[model samples]
Target: MADEKQPAVAPAPDAPREVTSKDGSSHEEITTPTRPPGWMYKGFKVFGHELWYASPLFQLLLVSLVCFMCPGMYNALSGLGGGGQVDHKAQDDASTALYSTFAVVAFFSGSIANKLGVRLTLSFGGLGYVIYIASFLSYNHNQNHGFVVFAGALLGVCAGLLWTAQGTIMMSYPTEDMKGRYISWFWIIFNLGAVIGSLIPLGQNINKVAGPVTDGTYVGFLVLTLIGAVLALCLCDVGKVQREDGSKVIMMKNPSWITEFKGLFETITSAPWVVLLFPMFFASNTFYTYQSNDMNGSQFNTRTRALNNTLYWLAQIFGAVIVGYALDFAGARRSVRAKGSFIALIILTFAIWGGGYAWQKDQVTREETAEEGFVTVDWSDGGKKYVGPMFLYMFYGFYDAAWQTCIYWYMGALSNSGRKAANLAGFYKGIQSAGAAVFWRLDGLKKPFDTMFGATWGLLGGALLIAAPVIWMKIQDTVPLEEDLKFSDETVADVAGAQGAADQAVTAQPEAVRTSKEGGGAKEVV
Candidate 1:
């Protein structure tokens, strides 16, 4: 409220607004209709109107593209060094740093997104991924690990911003009826980074290239990332995201630093969030470190990395799409979808996966070089005939798909309104980063594979186990099924609920694109 007008109380619950913060701050956001004078999009046309360019669906696509590029390149690049298996501790060291930094950065991402607007926040975060990838061009194996850690830190900061932006925008663009479909599609498009990035390394790791990394191929990947970064910068600004009634979703409020700080504190301290810390926090890091360290090329040749990732991504794509439908099929109850999906993602349910890992553990042979890093066991004896792990890792796609979609989608239910929802999404990634940082500390102290399998089951899988019962029995969102409601409920009293309604209609536009207004003018609310 520092730089904005006083909040206006909504006459109805269906109104595009929140009446106040949980912290007892009395602020009523206003939703008002005010379109730019119609010339901004120029001649862009769909159905003969120059309005299609401004549609939230179009904006969502641009946002998705912004989310795609850098991480895709990083996924391809992160798998490159140490024979794609040997120097995994180094990989953990870098990743630990990435997530550790990400935790702190994520705490602030919502406020940053609020202040800078979504498009710019996304661009800023994407650039961080690009820079982290570029830093890899100078990797010199054992001699330059510190540089890798530094690069990881850079990636961590941007990732906090990027993921928060992604979650907020994705959640903001769909109406109650189509959210499941949209969330499912969003997961597929976003997770394509993993699938698509896998191909780059497959090409780069050809034995003909000799070393684990090929400089020329890596340079090409950098160029592709550069192009992607530029495109992300071209997305629509937040002030332009219009709702179904032509009232634009405004996010321009400049709340005091004290409010932002308190909001961050409140989010981390919430009961629902405390319950999520064990199973979900650090969950990605555990899964990823295992993937990067153990199963990647442990029992097979480096080329198999691409084959492995290809299958993993494909399965995940199917998993993501199916999970979307599953959630929708479960209907509007957040408790049902959240609990049901958690039970389904229980990695242990796929007992065959653990069996497969055990089968491969005996097969892969490793040996260390004369490098000081040789202090570690060398599994490099071409590791056993790596045939089983490729298939084994693919099973995680389903697990990952279920975990990612449900978690991000459920965040909307946990919060009372859009602004709080943004922060909750930030915590989803942030606290996890803190946990990842701690797990990654296992890097140099023990055989990476031992820690990888142990932590993967212990955390990623454990989180699901803990969440299943807790979400079912104990935890519930303060704003349950908030996204499922159509904004207006007949039971609520209203005096002037129709005041903000606009006559002009939007087709295929998002109902979630909330419009806000204050006494002086329309204030953008995240």
Candidate 2:
């Protein structure tokens, strides 16, 4: 007979008991795996098993699907340069408002997700997306900038909740070995939303030379987003989620508004090293304005822009896969993978941005002589010229995916607990949105293309430099459980105190050993 599968080991001493379902029908398992497995295992089935519902990969897919509909469609519209409207200014103005509120709300959204519950927060998050897409549909008919801008601001609030919860789940749900792979999977599914959403407009606007996207396009996007929103209600709470190995997700039980807010402050104070990544976060989305508007939108006509947009997001899937595999290369240590990814990011950044600078000079020449603002590169007409800019836009998409994957991977390195992951995700999105807000407003003011391009290049380089010290010196083979892992019922103060005590105890070990040797020549015994 084939060797029988071994039973899982008992849980570690400090690990929490598995949580039970609200209705008491099922109990979460707290067994330990002999070793971490890949995305699949022997006898793995896609459905009709308890493990399938509670699996981290499945949960990650659920969030990915939600994002694929909401932000994915949002990206499809945004990538169209002017939200598929002829007027770029209104899109710019609306983006400014959207990101401004997005920054503030996202910063606190982690706490909000914790206090209100991830399911409810996520369900509400999709509402803003629906409303925002509808505003675009209304703008197509009415030309009302005010309503569109208002919708932008409202969506910002909802996006904050959805993304914070999304981040928390992404970071905390996976085993250490699975973090990178999980991110890649989530990104692929999430961006597919953009890819598929782009297809709708690409198909509809294929023949029309130059005009706003049809009402049918917006309605289609709206329906998909609404479906995503309703699906959010189906997410399993963190308390009940179990990893493939049967370990429980670290959760904050019975969190109140007071504790939740206090926990946010503590995440900063306790893990101050995370601030080193703020510049990386800030630079993350800052280049979207230059890439989408100045380059793709200004350079291509309606149909070609849609084609380029589809390819841009398509590039993201490849980018995420590349970086994701690199980060999770099982042969290397986690720290080595992290440091290597950073260096690769730096090389890719310079290469892509440097190529962009050369392309921008050519774009500048065309802009000065063109009759209208748009430089009108029709894919059907221009052969050699079209290939260069389209490829450039696609590379821009790749660069974006690599940068974001690195950031999420770095943050995931810091902690595995759901509570801390939520705060870190919030901080990242908040800073990213703040930076985007500034750059989008600049685009609205009609900043020189060269200026935007130069800023993007400089900011990316500087952010990478600022993050070097932490990536090199601070990242470890593994985070200490005593330091990062916490009991569900512990308050912020209790968690901090435990960490402080752990530090003190660690620091005192050498001194005690020295004293013992000196007092009794008990070096061996001691």
Candidate 3:
């Protein structure tokens, strides 16, 4: 067949060949040394480095100060100009509306802030807050509840934007190693804000109002809001980074509005587990809203508030520093610890919820007795009479602190890798918003027959408690190979095979040269 064509042969898998060196000498294949993953090592280092300077902690403090200053004024405003003297239901509706706005705005603001730099978004929020407080002052002069609600909505929007940005900034820039610790510190400072906020209202002295108590409270908020705004401006810088090519750039790029709207939806679709964790946030916030309303009603006077705040902060500080360090030391795979913490938090929330229910019942009994003209015990005074409420307050404080600590810890742990943190935070806010919306809508429902608001909240919290451990187990079972394996078996085997082939080639080369010399009249087979 025209001098039969030689069949093509494939290279042997074990064959080795000389590789050229930089100096033109022939050498065998070079080996690359094994090294640890950069993300893991760098993540640890980053957590230790840059977490504290972010301003969420300080911003929370400012918001708390401003928020607490207005309750007395708002109460008075509701009663001004003989406005039918206002009832608990009216106040509840107003508060719900306000908080609902806060929840929704916060969710939207967070997404926008993620696309836009935290500094610019937060600074704008602060300025808007100033405008909101000014509107409140204007409302005080006008005596219009509608204007007050509008102002409150504006405040909610501003607060939502700033808080979302602050949270995102904290979550994004830190290393995985320090993420828990840094977020713990964030909560610690946030609790400190509650302490300070509770105290700021003490300075208002609404009982000794120069004009209406509403007027005095509005003035107080105005001053606090101004201070907050100035601090925000000083702390935030929107346009700061410059590229190597000499082009100025913002720290974050703003995405299209459509992208911002889709963030929550995208997160839920991508991470179904995120949806499961959201109910806990919602339940916790509902409890908080109820407690705030109770406190504002003077159910737990100033001293009680101070004591509760102090205890809460103490527990938070302890949990964050001590428990956070423990989690770090227990190694990176402490899914079990996160589960346990979540369970403990849920138990504590139940205790708080039960205590709140009991407290409400007691208040109703006292009101009924007073209405009947019966001499009631003044348990607000000393010793044994006050012990029950004091015990409740203290326990509630502990519960609040522990619950929040566990929440931050769990979130940090669950969202330790990939793009989980951003997704988790966004979904958490959205779920909390959904819960608030439900509760707000339900507040209009008439009762004494039956209602599901409290029961639904309690059930949601209980479900989350049960779900945490199961989820933790699943996470542990499906631990990523990249995270757990020191080296891939296949990769190691391939490397070993290459080395064996190299050794065989090295051993065979001299014999082949010797044979060639003998066959070619003793000439060297160079």
Measured against the true structure, the TM-scores of the candidates, in listed sequence, are 0.73, 0.85, 0.63
Shift of residue 403 alpha carbon in model 1, Å: 1.4
Give candidates' CA RMSD values in order.
11.0, 8.2, 14.6
Please report, in order, the local distance difference test score of every candidate based on alpha carbons: 0.58, 0.83, 0.45
> Per-residue lDDT tens digits of candidate 1, residues 1-526?
3523222322332345656656554444544433323323334543232344456556666666665566666665554433243446656677777888999999789877766766777777887776666555666334466777787898899889887877777765554334556677776766686677767677666453223555554576667667666887777665555444343442324455566666567655654445554457557555655565555544344565556666777677787798887866744465667667666766444574466457645643333222343222222333444434445667666666766776766654454333555676677778878877776676445554654576566555566656665567543533433232222121111211223332111112334223334333333233
Candidate 3, residues 315-427: lDDT per residue as tens digits?
A: 54565666556545545466666666655666665766666566555453323422434432233466744566656555655565565455555665443221234445555
Evaluate model 2: give its lDDT.
Answer: 0.83
Better of 1 and 3 by lDDT: 1
Q: What TM-score, to 2 decimals, does candidate 3 have?
A: 0.63
Clashes of each: 26, 0, 2
lDDT of 2 by residue, 1-526 (tens): 2333323443442232445445553332333344333333345544322235556767888989999999999999999988998769888998999999999999999989998878899999999999999999999888988999999999889998899999999998887887888898889999999999999999999897788989999999999999999999989877667554445667677888888888899988986877888999999999999888887777788898899999999999999999987898999999998889988999998999999988887665424624565457789765568888888899999999999998999999988788888988999999999999999999998888888899989999999999998898787888765566552564332332222333444455655433433355432111
User: Which parts of model 2 are misplaced by more than 4 Å?
Assistant: 1-42, 45-51, 365-375, 486-526
User: Which scores higher on TM-score, 1 or 3?
Assistant: 1
Regions more than 4 Å wrong, model 3: 1-91, 127-142, 203-218, 233-264, 295-332, 350-380, 416-420, 440-457, 469-471, 474-526
